[model samples]
Target chain A: MELLKPELGLIIWTTIILLSLIFILTKFAWKPILKGLNDREKTIAEALNTAEKTKLEMAAMKSQHEALLNEARQERSLILKEAKDMKDAIIGEARDKAKSEGAKMIEEAKREIDNQKMAAIIEVKNAAGNLVLEVSEKILRRELNSKDEQVKYINTLIEQSKLN
Target chain B: MCEYLCATKKRVIALKVLKFKLFITIFLLSVFSVSLVSAAHGEEETNSTAPTEHNESKKEDGKFNAKKVILEHISDSHEWHFFSYPTGDGYKDVALPLPCILYNDVNGFSFFLFNKLHHGAIDGYSLNAEHHIGRSDGEGFYDLSITKNVFAMMISSILLIWLFRSAAKGYGARPNQAPTGLQNLMEVLVSFVRDEAAKPFLGKKTDKYLPYLLTVFFFIWINNMLGLLPGGANVTGNIAVTTTLALFTFILILTGSRKHYWMHILNPPGIPFGVKLILVPVEILGIITKPFALLIRLFANMTAGHLIVLSFLSMIFIFGQMSPIAGGGISIFSIAFSTFIYLLEMLVCALQAYIFTMLSSVFISEAIAGGHDHDEHAAEDLP
Candidate 1:
């Protein structure tokens, strides 16, 4: 029976208490609590977003670095190939120039040798003529005094030069 | 996908913490409320006047009025009565009388401490054995007096203010840091009610109704716990308290109701004319019954919990009246069973508070679900 009687004072008091409590809590407690919770939530979300962005950026930078290295590697190989080709061309040109110069020098030496040989032969002939004249003069001196044979050899050479 | 799954795993952990925290709060709130009662009981013990000698009167009669004692324990009174003690000569009834305020046609407002009427009638006002104040002249008057239940509420209300105010200050003092102590307790409960109770039903409109829901939840929760303490007022058990709580939900439902709600109630869609005639009245009845169910559920659960506990305690005295030996033997059973029952009641306190708040949000959501216009707005919002 006592349980059934929902007292009037209690009802009114409960109404007043609850209404005021709602007002006060809504104003003071729930507002800030909710706001703080929301702010924290926003911060956490932002952190996760930044983390994801950083991870993507890092991956992009890694790929970009790899691409730059590959370009540099290709450029290096191309420069090496060009240098090898230029070295081979320069070496071939130098060898050809040296070979032609050596051939020309050998031809010039041969011509000089030929000229000297000719001069030597002419000298030997002159000597040989003098030697024949001397031998004939010796034979004539054996026969009749040296002065008369020498004059004979000189006269013979003079007549031969005039005929020529 | 990884990120979403991680978030879900975090949410599950967070929900566990919330439940644990809410558990601490109600349990701690009971202890806190009981401490207040202890202080009051101590004061009343020193201040209580001794009754005229009824020394060992019950022993002489060998009769223990278990029903009267248990009912009085569960009911409200004009004063806070702790217990009765027998001295060598007389017995002592420790009670703190409250100020009585009444309104009648003859007397607009009369005020006095309930102790004034302790001895006899005062100014034609008399207190019945049931602790109701009535006029000797047989005139009905409004009892605006601060009864025991009222004082208990006042204490809890003040405590509520202090707690939440401090929590609000914690929010100000520390904006984004994790909650600690009382602030943490309040936050967990607030979030729980928001997420588990309001958000599930009210959805985006959760913030709009969170305050009222939180208030009623904490009110019922704290009061239910307080009532479980020895000699605490059965505030939530009282039908009046639950009715008032229900009235708040009913008002919210009625006021926040959109046109579509009434249309659905008055003329449910896709129904024939004959079916509409039958269904409309049932739908209207449904509106009233929603809150009524909220009221009765909380009131009955709280009242029954107290009743079972009190009945268990009464068993000792009942068996003691049979024989002192039987009483001594059964006390272990009574106390052990009652302790187990008491723990069960503690859970029911949380359960009842939860049911009341959840059901309330459900009703409010039903009223405020404004129909397909929201979907149309969503469609219109697309590029």
Candidate 2:
């Protein structure tokens, strides 16, 4: 009977002991230990989330960088083509201007050379005419002194005039 | 690296110490068993020439009554009796007789050591033949002494406080760091109870009930372990302790239950009226039985475990009544078998704690309708 009986004292003691144990453990034991575990869990989860976000961001940045590099490559080729076209246009314009200027200068030199040749010819003719008149007078005077010599000289002069 | 080396070295030392302690305990238990049989043998030798009726009367009294001893072992007592040694003339009990407190209408209160009332009476209070304290006049008085179970509970409570507070201190000293040593060990148990027992059932309300759940788990487990010590008091095996624990859970259920719980119990939706009639009563019975089951299951398991181990240990004496040679030979087998049961009981200690916490969580979760949505979804899926 004693073995089976639940003593009121033990019941009271158990109740008191258990309730107080729950109270004390709740305050000191379970609270802090659980808090530590929870805090650690939360930090771990947060760290994982941050890591995942960072990985995504890195991937996104990598793709953005690739796109930027591609755009730069395209822009460089376009600029290079524009520069080559401008160089070609400037070279062609310069070559054409040099050719035209050279031709005009050569034409002006040829005209001046022709004008100098005509002026030289005119002066020479005037000089030759003056000399010829002097020589004919001298000859007429000399022939009056000698009639035969004059006639002969006149004939020779007429023949020479005709041959001339 | 230093840490690791230190830990391994500490573990080896601890293992050695544990083995030595186990050896000493087994050796002491064997001595006690031998002493018990020798005492019985002495009684039998003196009574051998006596008449049959005389011997029969003396048989149960002094011939190593295993039942009495086993019952005494599992049962609570006013004294923490360790063991007895035969003195020059008679046996002297080597035990700590606890103090007693008594109160009645006549005498408001009386306080004294248990031995003061050993002979006759102390201030109108006497401990009966069974050592239960009672008033000399046979009137009722409140027996409020700290019995063996109470003492054991106190020790376990203090132990739990010390253990967890040290872990708490660890967290306090180094927050958000990896746990080490005792803190690590405690974290394993705490995390286990939370993840395995509390969270799976409680869900969002896991934190709210953690203290209660954690307390129950540690209390039962620590007490169960304490009871496994040589001559340790059976704290969890007591009905009072389990009842109190169950009552706490019951109160929590009552206070925490939601409307859906009652709705599901009292009025079922889309069910046959006749089925509702049957299911309603069953659901209502389920409420009380949840806690009741928690109470009986723990008490029965712990008590049965102790009973088996002690009964196995007592086998030597039971056989000794037949022959001394048989007694000596069976002692070896009894010790081995009992040691096996003892190790099994160690596992049962933690297992029973887990079961109690799990069932409590299940019942609590049911009451609070914590997993109502999941259940509803499952129902939809099934249909």
lDDT of 1 by residue, A1-164 (tens): 76788888889988888888889878887888888888878888998999999999999999999999999999999999999999999999999998898898889989989989999999989877886686666555655446767677656655555455
TM-scores of chain A, one for each prediction: 0.53, 0.54
Predicted complex 1: CAPRI docking category:
medium
- Each candidate structure's TM-score, on Cα atoms with residue i matched to residue i, is 0.73, 0.72
What DockQ do you compute for every candidate structure? 0.53, 0.49
lDDT, candidate 2, equals 0.83
- Candidate 1: regions farther than 4 A off: A71-164, B1-62, B376-383
Q: Quote the lDDT for B327 in model 1.
A: 57
Weakest lDDT window of 10 consecutive positions for candidate 2 chain B: B51-60
List clashing residue pairs in candidate 2. none
Question: Which number leads on TM-score?
Answer: 1
